[model samples]
Target chain A: MSIEGSSPKSLFDKLWERHVVVEETAEAPAVLYIDLHLIHEVTSPQAFSVLEGRGVKVRRPDKTFGTLDHSTPTLPANDRGELPYATPEAKSQVERLIENCAEHGIELLNMGDPRRGIVHVIGPELGLTQPGKTIVCGDSHTSTHGAFGALAFGIGTTEVGHVLATQCVLQRKPKSMRVVFDGLLPEGVGAKDMALAMIAQIGADGGQGYAIEFAGEAVRALSMEARMTLCNMSIEAGARFGMIAPDETTFEWLHGRDYVPKGLAWNEALADWTDLRSEIGAHFDKEVHVDATKIRPMITYGVSPDAAAPVDALAPEPHSEAEKHAADYMKFNAGKPFHDVAVDRVFIGSCTNSRLSDLREAAAVMRGRKVKEGVVALIVPGSEAVKHAAEAEKLHEVFLAAGAEWREPGCSMCIAMNGDSGKPGELVVSTSNRNFIGRQGKGVRTVLASPATAAASAIEGHIADPRPYLFAKESA
Target chain B: MSFDPIKTLTSRTVVLSQENIDTDQIIPARFLTTTVKDGLGASAFYDWRYDEDGRPKNSSVFNGVDPETHKILVAGSNFGCGSSREHAPWALADFGFRAVISSDIADIFKSNAQKNGLLPVEVDEETHKKLLASPGAQVTIDLETCEVTFGDGEKGSFPIEAFARRCLLDGVDPLGHLINQMPAIEDYERQR
Candidate 1:
């Protein structure tokens, strides 16, 4: 209630108040209008089936978009028209999605379509995810779209069908949390590192049922791409959504995107988006202040996102039973050096960290280097568009020359739905969002790191710190 | 087939002692096959159900007793911490578990549980410890009163969203609710 001189409202509170389509019972969950509904193949087949069973047509086809990811292949289809997926089961899922979206009249961004990308990536790049709107997808990483100050969260496929049918979702209001990273970030640390550091401070489940907003000088200084990387993994911190106030970086990134408002409409949209900030005296249910300068390049040694620390730090002691299990699962011993953990493979792409800028970060690290012997390094861009841009800028050459495979875009090795998985028990330094057991493959050991860290580890044959290996251009 | 409405259940609790037991551990992503919703129970906890080479792990609850017989799960705090997979609840429900009792539960998982027929009962730490200590204790969850009783008859009331409670009691989902009240909803829309 920012009625007149009422107390200053937080970012989420303001956005929440503006987007409620229906005011239901007092303190009851409200019917929130969803501005954008992103659907991907892996999670939507069941949702569409549910819709068909109910005999409902999609309510707002214009507002909904579909893309083939997760189940799509990084390698192109063979001469037989069969996708290069390990399982036909995966291929059929994406095929079902194509049919489902076509039947519903929703736009499906097929592979090799320049617009086709990770749903999260394409949503922002096409200017679909704007400030002060509500977004949902059947996938959890829909939180990635929240970087633009949108209230974005992932819903289950059941809710996905509901949103498709009504464009409105029944939701309980999430409490507000503001985590401020004050001061300047230390050198060699970027958004991914900052994300890991934040998770370290707040455990995996710390931000449950909270719409978290990042604020302060450190967050403000990040590039829009970096800010997206930060917000992308906020789900790992147990938040369905995370936001950063729309400032110059956010506006600049949105300015000329494919569908951004133009001319007077652009100016009007900008004015509205510019005001999407927490009031100076905003109330937050929980507030965490981080000394950004103290943060260093971070990495996750254990299975969960919260089992993270500074790259140079040793493995965490197993004080808790969960830690013990994670250590056992990872085949890692406490008190061992983090970087000494050898890796057999390295993957650089995901909705979490696969964009033009993320590729550039890895390219810089790979420029004058070579991937270590026996390391199967790969660079899969977030979209075909990102891949084309990287190729034009010679980032692809840089990676290829350094022995990293430049593959087509999809969620390659991210969820391992595609055939791009490392051998079982093979340790991998991956840039994907999850480090869950068997997430990459059966019994595959995953160590989550930033793109730069992943590149450096590829070159070093272990989980090496990227600070010492940053290219002069990157450091400068 | 439509889900059966779970009004009341009494059974020995299956204790899974570990915090932050994520959805992946509940059901790994690899087993997330089939657009079909029913019968994911056998695949649930696929890894925990079996050892590395494929034999069923002796320590697993699935192997120990019929999951259908033990209708309640007493897990450590922060159960279902990762991913928003509704499959987790579907699997648990397929196994005939009516409810999950935890000191804390992730927001998405709890919401997913509510939408499905599985009830989530959040007990205090002390109550959780007693339940964990006395594994197989006859825990009875009364959805009518929102109370979970076990551990020598000590009981605690867990809060449920009033809207969700009504739906669960009526054996309906949100889709069902909207369908049932379509006329009233359209009238309200027209008034607006």
Candidate 2:
């Protein structure tokens, strides 16, 4: 099992090799031990029903956690009584989740609980997600947990049922792809820009069927929040999962969290984590690198996340017939400059960017500024915890003072699953992932950007650079 | 275990000219909330074929077509591009689409479709165009030969993976394919 090279293998290679259950079995799928499983209101119902039909108890309830998001309404605290949850249809689903969690002995963070938020967000914040763990959730954004150096991925309801029944998942090991980013990012260029630039470099399917391990100096220096942002969009690049090995920054983030190891166990955990780096000269199936300094604040003009370009760069000329056809369908004029394209709305929230730091960045831009007249700007925190933290820090006040509507935490405007959506035909600057046509709502045009860019777009009523604000804030 | 591959196909083909049509749109997220047996066929193409009122739109080709008669879906490039919801293929299979003729399809969607016994025929652009132009032009996809023939005798040989072809011909799924090798597996298990 020894990798025979002097050059150290990347951390991804080491962990993956360590977890090899069966060596490429053609007759049977490999069985992998799952360390943590997170579930949400949307994808857990059918899984629970399956368990019920089988009369089986969750095999590893201790490793499972549940939360309510997606369908949870973002009504003002005062208006909770009048919200959709008050309706029978919504209430039953929410109630069923509570009952299911109780029946399975799984931890339930229902709506209104301070810990309640997007399942992905709460997993890491509470130290439930850790390095070397295999995490799966019934949500696509589950890759967000990979920021902790875990192999986290999304699963379907049936797979969720299977995991609950057996506490093991049938999996085929994926080929590994290493993505390296050199140099430091400029002030305004955040993790979202890094992810978008990577997606753009590698077409949407470049990393298909591979686990991408992000490395290099730029990635190593990123905060846990930034790393989560990088991993959240791995799915967009068509990677099964994205991960970064846990470092000092990672350990510091998990130090005193509720579910994290304590005292002697904490020291032992650190010792193990320290050994988690890749072995010397381990081989990867593929490797790609990006110059972090070359990437600018990016935005998506088309449906897929990969259809993106640097903010200052003009939209690409349609080089292929497929490109021409797709551009025509999206009504995007290729080769045309989108320099001051006005936006009808701006959204700043979702699992991708609803973090506390994300809110702070947006707040810095909104300070002493008002949202452009006639344009709707909304901010939804990713989780109830984030909402509370932001409120305590008065980030919500800053957003509200700037004429932005501050709402509760949920997956608002990210997928339009809940009722939060933009009107058709309206152009929006969003901090969420995916800009697919009607992704926000039917016919709504979305431009995915960083929170700072989204906030600046709201103030200027068009796509604009946030360099001045970010720099000024950094210096002050 | 042998099955008639041609009998698995339907008579009429419906064309959807769009690339990157996701599984979510094929079967909306709402339907995913229920069990696998709660009738996904009736809800197939729920988003694209209907308006907000749940009424079939005249603009959609699916509006007036009888479910049983329309067995093949002639789709544009990059069909089935989103979430790996097997329900997309389930709905399509349940709705009587025996085969999907597309210039391209997302890899996972194609695999899921094949596993569910829905033939995914990858045709060239020229063949796809001719098929679309002539709505009544029936294309016979022979799984045994891996060839497609239109009514005008426009014949083209398409490539399918050997494993997938074997599965389709044998009327087997991935599990079924493995089951066929049970003796060897048991022998290996005994040795272990």
Candidate 3:
């Protein structure tokens, strides 16, 4: 994107070339400067402990931001004025992050902050994420920021320490991959479905060792929230980073948000951002295309995210030992439809979903529809901001009317680290990302779906297609 | 934290051949609330190693093996996928796996493992099949030569990033390396 030469470069190449502080050599990885560093409680404590032991201050505290999500309770305090933490360790994890951020002079959005939310959700909502910036977070869903055209990816605790001490992460450039979704997505299908369908086409590890750029007609047609949903699941497909080139839609969404450049600075930022796209002949190491029209409302039938199929399709027969194990664990009959799979729990929040638009999508399906008996549905907002926005629209009333627990903002049941979990052997249809074994809880089977699909399944007490509900709403 | 230098490791392999063995399986999220890195070995593969009542399951894959003698884990293809938890490698290292040999290793896990002194050696499909077939077979992994020698005198070379190999061979922490490059990083930031 820079005026390096007439040679065309992919978006990943452009982003990579911009972030290199020192070129990689045979003996060492490249020293890549980070513009923004997002940290959460679960992974940051050890990194902070290591930094404290070294007696080193954070290299650039201004660039670092912290929040508590993974272990924070979505339920409010009880009559004793005590937050019901999952365990003493989970409570201490949150406290440690607050202390560390204070010690390092880094900005932290603490418990009472209205801006506090999931690390990935708050970043873009506050406009801290922007085009052409290199962002690193201690959470894998940090790829959500990539939908804004930032070169964002997740890092481990050691890398977290490295970033804190030096403000740069050592890295090798990942090869570029371009996944283009052709044509228009049909009604009743959404970004989560597209993500699931893409992963199903390409195995769970399809994008390994590569940085993927989601492009083409469907990607361009998506709203910022939908794009985030699509990109948030990149890690499930084994890509560390998933990005979209910034366009007018991105600029419009970010224009009035907090932390964005203003007035003359805004115009200058836009000028540079317009050049962020890959050129016509830009080369990608790998390229994949999905027929958007053929995609339907999809849900994972197995433990892995890639074990996805259309909601109306029959459950797949065990193809391998792993599949057989997954089938036995999931308790799904090979020839039966996913619709017959009973759902005991429905969770409609995570970094992957739970944006205001995602909330609206689910609320539209839940309005005037009662949740089926024995199915406990939870509607958690991704951030405090999203919660307030949805509340302003009275979306909570609709969920409450439908018998869903309208909960506070936090990861909640997604990671099951916040005392919110499905009972053992329960089947939960979740809008969150991972469905790995015991992800929701011990012996809990997780089926990943979109917010709308989750809402419909909650109403039906089974894994039902969302198209009928969506169509019924349209006609009404 | 520092790790022991791994020049050559000759040990029997502990095999768990289920493909796409994710981080959640390695160390479930429930056991991840700790701030410190120590004592995670007991919880490594917790779900697989324990029954619902919190008792150890004798039929677990890790039951028969001794951690001291079998220091290498030869797992299925696409091992360590899903979450970006470095805890996965930390748990494995604490459980006495000095190396993880697989046909395909997830990108982030490979980086995390190398930094934590748990080497991820990715072999070709044929070699992986051989490794899978011979679970406790004695294997020698030479970091200096970047090669793995396994059962029946079969051998294969594995790929590791040069910088990671250097750090592993020298027993140096990558954080220290990044800290040393701070001046260059500041220079780049100033220009921006």
**Highest TM-score scorer:** 3
List the candidate 2 regions with Cα displacement exceeding 4 Å: A1-10, A20-23, A77-82, A86-88, A317-336, A473-476, B1-17, B28-37, B52-55, B63-65, B74-78, B84-87, B98-192
All DockQ scores:
0.51, 0.19, 0.86
**Residue-wise lDDT of candidate 2 within A52-168, one digit each (tens)?**
875878877998899888777787545445556434545567778899999889989976588988877889899998888788876667788888889888766656776787665
> Candidate 2 at A157: error in angstroms?
1.7
Q: Write the per-residue lDDT of candidate 1 for residues A432-470, one digit (tens) a residue.
A: 888888888888999888999999999999889987777
**What is the C-alpha lDDT profile of model 1 across B43-85, one tens digit per residue?**
7778888987889888777667666678888898889888888
Candidate chain B TM-scores, in order: 0.89, 0.86, 0.96
The per-prediction tally of clashing pairs is 0, 9, 0
TM-scores for all candidates? 0.96, 0.86, 0.98
Tell me the deviation in Å of residue A286 in model 3: 0.7
Fnat measured on candidate 2: 0.05
Query: How high is the lDDT of residue A58 in model 2?
Result: 85
Query: Which 10 consecutive residues of model 3 chain A have the lowest summed lDDT?
Result: A467-476
The candidate with the higher TM-score, 1 or 3, is 3
